[model samples]
Target: MDDPTPEVADQEAPSSGIAKAQPEVGPPLVEMVNVWKRFGQGAGETVALAGVDLAIQPGEFVTLIGPSGCGKSTLFNMIAGLTDTDSDGSVVFKNKPQRDGELLGKVSFMPQKDLLFAWRTVLDNATLALEIEGVPRAKARARAEAMFPEFGLAGFEKHYPHQLSGGMRQRVALMRTFLFERELMLLDEPFGALDALTRAMMQRWLLEIWEKHRRTVLFITHDIDEAIFLGDKVVVMTARPGRIKTVETIDLPRPRGAEVITSPEFIEIKRRLLGIVEEESLKSFASAGAS
Candidate 1:
């Protein structure tokens, strides 16, 4: 397996900054065209994904929901250029050579674990990416410092990872990812570690942040409720050797609140997504039992 590409570390790099004259809205930001990923060699090979074709429009929040081993991470790795597809059946992102850094700082990814540094203060950890890029320490710290307050991490800047609660730690981790200044974000179970109440609060907090920022986001999770709650569209995948199952647009109104989850429209959408997920889950269970 080839190593993943290095992430771009520029904290203050001039953004792509499209001009108003161009109207700035054309093609989708990322396109995965007939992508397939298989792991290992010969009989031991695991076919993780197959024939995936999807386009994520700018500022769209898309979610992927499926049982474990459904190739969710495999798909993510392809998008991040962390893994390669066969030259024939490949994934194309940002309309450039998939191997290039064209999409590097333009996209940010937050993994399942918070992965915060134990030794560093929250502000230091958040600015580490910028520090690595050779941004002056003072400048990086200043940029990162302001975000702690914006991310609801105001009082914790001086604290370490061990000093924060689970949800607070996750917030810091997320701010760190955001400081990379990407136009897109890929999140994998970002709130899974939190308690139910904290998860609900974080969900609401995330929506508020997303509304203000308007970046394209592709989020992966096993939680059906979360998928429906956070996504503008939910894209389902098959059990193994995952393929596009369905893409359901969430018709709920923007700036959705907790009450929206109880509305008839929201319930209906959740019911439909749950039905599809249930069907796929059964197939996955059966396949595992047979093996």
Candidate 2:
């Protein structure tokens, strides 16, 4: 396969990249056009994301995957309204432009590390978002308490972060995100730190919950299998100064189990995604060598 031409890591880069799985129908819940992010200028400048366009329908599960330093997390930040896009770019949410500062608290975000507080009990940690929204501690705890059974933390509400296993901590973090109650959820490799078996279990459990709630989710991962398993559409991104390289819709039947990974269709999608990712990864390494 021919190597992908780099996006030049700057504002002068190409305007459009790949936008696969373009909505089957209906308006998108989130849309980003010509987005760019640069840190510093002159010799010390670093371009994180180049011009890119992407859209996700309401309640859709979109998984973003790319090689390291490709700005996968940077893209997530822009969507969560935690970071800003450059001038002339747009981050539109629910039909309104989000460049001015509207996205701040409109979405819920879960980063790689759970960042749970040690002193706080699981209940306190899970209810933190509610507490921030001015809900009384009693009310916040009450609401979170009700969902513990579903979250698998039913009897562990009084347990501290340090007392919980790695997977458990992640579950609490997700519950906190869910309690925030927004239409969009950005999860940045929430399962990246766990053991292989634990990670697999978390993936299955997450799908079940997502099916029940039907909330829109944007997940980031370097693991292609995880990305395909969790997302309705798997979005492949380019090297540093990230941009979409392809957007493939996951056609696998839902309520999926680990056996799904062995299916011929699943294998085919993985093969294609791996080819694109390998090409970009090599390009990134070559650039590093030349630098």
Stretch of 10 with least lDDT, candidate 1: 14-23
Question: Candidate 1: RMSD over Cα atoms?
Answer: 9.6
Runs with alpha carbons beyond 4 Å of true place in candidate 1: 1-25, 100-106
Q: What TM-score do all the candidates reach, one by one?
A: 0.88, 0.93
Clashing pairs in 2: none
lDDT scores in order: 0.78, 0.88
Question: lDDT of candidate 1?
Answer: 0.78
Question: RMSD for each model, in Å, please?
Answer: 9.6, 4.4
Badly placed stretches (over 4 Å) of model 2 are: 1-23
Give the backbone clash total of model 1. 0
On a 0 to 100 scale, what is the lDDT of residue 255 in model 2?
86
Q: Could you tell me the lDDT of residue 201 within candidate 1?
A: 95
Best lDDT among the predictions, by candidate number: 2
